[model samples]
Target: MLYATASQTVGPYLHIGLADRYCDDLTGDAPGLRDSRIVIEGRVLDGQGAPVPDGMVEIWQANPNGRYRHPEDERTHLPLVDGFTGFGRVPTGPDGSFRFITVKPGAVPDVHGVPQAPHILVSVFMRGLLKHVATRMYFPDEAAANANDGVLRLVPPARRDTLVARRGDDGALRWDIVLQGEGETVFFDI
Candidate 1:
């Protein structure tokens, strides 16, 4: 009998081995980056809007020139910055807050050659989940580009606001993720 193994939730101790790679800064003080640096800070909230203190958030994005650091990104026309890895991971604090410092990513082209909006791909891992949920953090300032993004178009108009991070008076981007219930964040099936 080939019974499948039971599913398990994501974590209670995600920070164990992951702490070594806990990078909150994608741009490691490297100069020559073509875009302005930005700070993104946010909280991971449960359905009731309480913080999920033991969660982790990971982000991947293209460089400021719209090129990824991965080998598969054959866009040689886009220059990669010297010290920017374009990837970051941060564990949530006791208040469920996480922060990242990086340059604003440029628009990357989709598979069909359509340009996506300047956005950071996010993955959330926490307790009570069989697997991580995927989402995106779009810049609120890039409204025109966001409007034309193929991926953003797939999200329902009424729910798209969940994906856009708002800039605060302090000049940092603020985005909160709600795991479930009312005003839940729009997570993708990927």
Candidate 2:
């Protein structure tokens, strides 16, 4: 009988591998950037409403055409955009703010061919967390699609707002993430 070993804790040194300038941009040198430009900006807050300065945020999503870049995603009808890798990473600044510039992802189908809402898959890594936290950021404007999303329905109605990002006057999405306490962002096990 083999027992699993204890998990190791993450530390404040995530910048070494995750925050290198090369891995920070997802919309680099592409016309797609001009056409589908949007900024996802937010801060990572801790239980006491303080910024988690050492945290790192990573996002993965389908391209604007709803197609993933991975070879396993063999949907031929979906249009592919040049220079969009459907992934990005950024580190929290001194104030725990993080921002991602990328096109809004299109609706991807579920296992049963149901069209899920357009949303970005977010993962957060930081010191003191044994494992990263997983969440999704849905667009507040995608009301109809969001109403039909299978994953969004799982969250209780009252707390669901935590997952939706609001668009600002400048067209940037403001979606702050709280690690604990009231109004904490909903994290999924998977």
Candidate 3:
């Protein structure tokens, strides 16, 4: 999806659904078997800071092992995670927050085929925002490789931390999406 910041920032967002076909970011390869089951929940908001309650947030990611559903992948030797769909949707709450219950995603290698840190990639589509900004949600504090991700390397240093989730007291990762204002999700141009 594309957006023009100055004007007409509302009223149109290219229907990304048409690109329903997704392959692994690395090789444009599909999954050997279906294994990813991730849920993304967040609110859709307008420029005036109001919740767009009826908006939709679409999410897609690889299985825990980092395999996609694309047909060209050649790695079927790996075991598949069970009971996971690798995709899901959720609407925002009254205050403009949404929640999803999905399993943690596996890792996908970089352009060099070097295994990068694991993460859940999310897409936000709301009312008024012309495009569904796409960003990746990373596991908190995986220091060793967080510094190794090729994509993460592109974000300006100060903003990269917000891209990862922080661990909650319950040991689960928690991340919030702020549609507008300072600290909005760092969307990518990929």
| Weakest ten-residue segment in model 1 by summed lDDT | 27-36
TM-score of 3: 0.71
Compose the digit string of candidate 1's lDDT tens values, residues 1-190.
8999988887697678877889998877577753578999999999898999999999999988899999999999889888898899999989999999998988899999989999999999998899999999999999999999999999999999999999999999999999998879999998
TM-score of each model, paired residue for residue: 0.96, 0.93, 0.71
Kindly report the root-mean-square deviation of model 1 from the true structure over all alpha carbons. 1.4
lDDT of 2 by residue, 29-89 (tens): 6675776788899999999999999888999999888999889899988977788888888
lDDT of 3: 0.63
**CA shift at 145, candidate 2, in angstroms?**
0.7
Candidate with the greatest TM-score versus the true structure: 1
The order by descending lDDT is 1, 2, 3
What C-alpha lDDT, on a 0 to 100 scale, does residue 74 get in candidate 3?
59
Clashing pairs in 1: none
Clashes of 1: 0
92 Cα displacement, candidate 3 (Å): 1.5
Rate residue 153 of model 3 by lDDT: 86
> RMSD to the native, candidate 2?
2.0
Ten-residue region with minimum lDDT total, candidate 2: 17-26
For each candidate in the order shown, give its overall lDDT on alpha carbons. Answer: 0.92, 0.89, 0.63
Order of quality (TM-score): 1, 2, 3
